[model samples]
Target: MRGNILQKSFIALQWKTSFTSQYLVAPTQVIKSMNVGNIRFIADAKNSGSKLEATVFQDDHHRDGRWWNISTEWKVACSFVVAVTSFFLNARYERIQVQKEIKLNRIQSQIKDLYGPLYGNRLVSDTSYRAVMKSHKGLKKYLSEARRKKDAEMIHCWRSYVWNVLYPLDKAAVDLILNNAHLIAQGEFPKEFEQLLMHAARMEFVMESWKNDDGALESAKRFDDDDYLEVSNASGLIFRTQILTHVKQKYDTLRDEQKQILLDISSDKQADDILAKIYQKVTHQDL
Candidate 1:
């Protein structure tokens, strides 16, 4: 009985070893089964280059008698396999979600006419907006030099549309000047006249360049400089004040056509002749 038990244990060990080896070489090969009483042994061919065999012997007459013999050729085989299902899932779904978010932000920025509206209008700030406008200086200079009609028309349209949006802010600057005109005109000489005159010219230039000429004219007409005289008694001392006075008088007294002609031409004999007379009368200065 003891000998039989020992034989079965040895057979089991041999079977396990054989199964492991066979799997290590070729995992797909089916195992063959051998039975002895209540015990079973399995084996498969591995590494076909070498012909090997294993066998187990049993005694039917002796109830407690058995012996086994096995060889490496019958061992099972296996190979390493890596399943990367999680890697594919992460790439196809998780990474795609991140890419989608970035694309959405980019589209939003383009639509808003800002480089990054979601980022608090970082690229659309006043400084950056002005910088972008300044970039068109090259294009404008090129078009002017080339004198291409199509390019000129395109440039004009771009400038017009830009002023449409920016003119309101420009008008606000004039309002600031109008508000502080008294303080500025009353202050020190040379400095005060320079500042006030610059303010006045800036206002006029903005109004002239604004999209709606009639509207800008009407808006500009709303500011009254009569009180400006109260700020300074030395109005005759500075040429800037005289120039501002000349411009105001022209705007106030001239017909629409005459005003347009004066604004349009840099040097017009007729327009200058008329302005010269007005300048002599209002400011008591020769043009």
Candidate 2:
């Protein structure tokens, strides 16, 4: 009886030792290859005699592995969310900046138009005139020579300048003619004065049409094309010429007394002087 008990104790010790060795030394592939029955048998054997908790160790390892995988997945998710948020924020900022720049440019343009000529004349004191002359010295010299020679191209160039810059009809100038329409109709103004006013009004109409129909105001501000300048000048001249011719034809159909009134108005020295000063202001030149 004593021998059998000792032998049983020895066998139990060996079994425990074998189970511990297998659990500790088994590779993942070897553990995976074990059948459910084998695993259960090992677990039962380990539970029966061993004080070391093999099942507890395995449970702790599984929980730790699961926690590690969850941590990794959460970190990746957080990074992606932060990246998307930052991208949207940056895009929104850029859009706001662009809008601010556009508004600033518009305000600057309005300020320039209101005060530019008052600060410096384009033909005389402005830096832009010097810059243009410096950059196109040859062209300037050639144009001067051509003007002296009465070249047709030079004449056309000067005419373009006159229409585009000298005789440009702004709101103030347009208002002047529109407000004096009663005087024109009553023959209280000279035929020459009436024709000039008609020309200015028609040119204003043409400019407004171009601005509204062709969306040319923004392009005109750029001043990058000689062709556009030429077209604008020619268009202004043609419109004014047509209107003036019509007015003259109508005047010819008027009675002798009306014609005499127009002649008397034209011959008024004081009125002519006032008209000349107004023309000088509009054209920025000595008439």
Q: Which run of 10 residues does model 1 get worst, by summed lDDT?
A: 226-235
Give the total clashing residue pairs for model 2. Answer: 0
Please give, for residues 142-203, the per-residue lDDT of candidate 2 as tens digits: 45555455455554454454446545433333454455444243445445444555656656
Model 2 C-alpha lDDT versus the unseen true structure: 0.45
TM-score of each: 0.22, 0.25
Model 2: how large is the Cα RMSD against the reference?
29.3
* Alpha-carbon lDDT of model 1: 0.40
Shift in Å, residue 32, candidate 1? 99
lDDT of 2 at 214: 62
**What's the residue-level lDDT of 261 in candidate 2?**
43
lDDT by residue (31-149, candidate 1, tens digit) is 44445543333434455544333344443524443322222222321111123664675478556556655644443333233211212322132344455547555333433432433
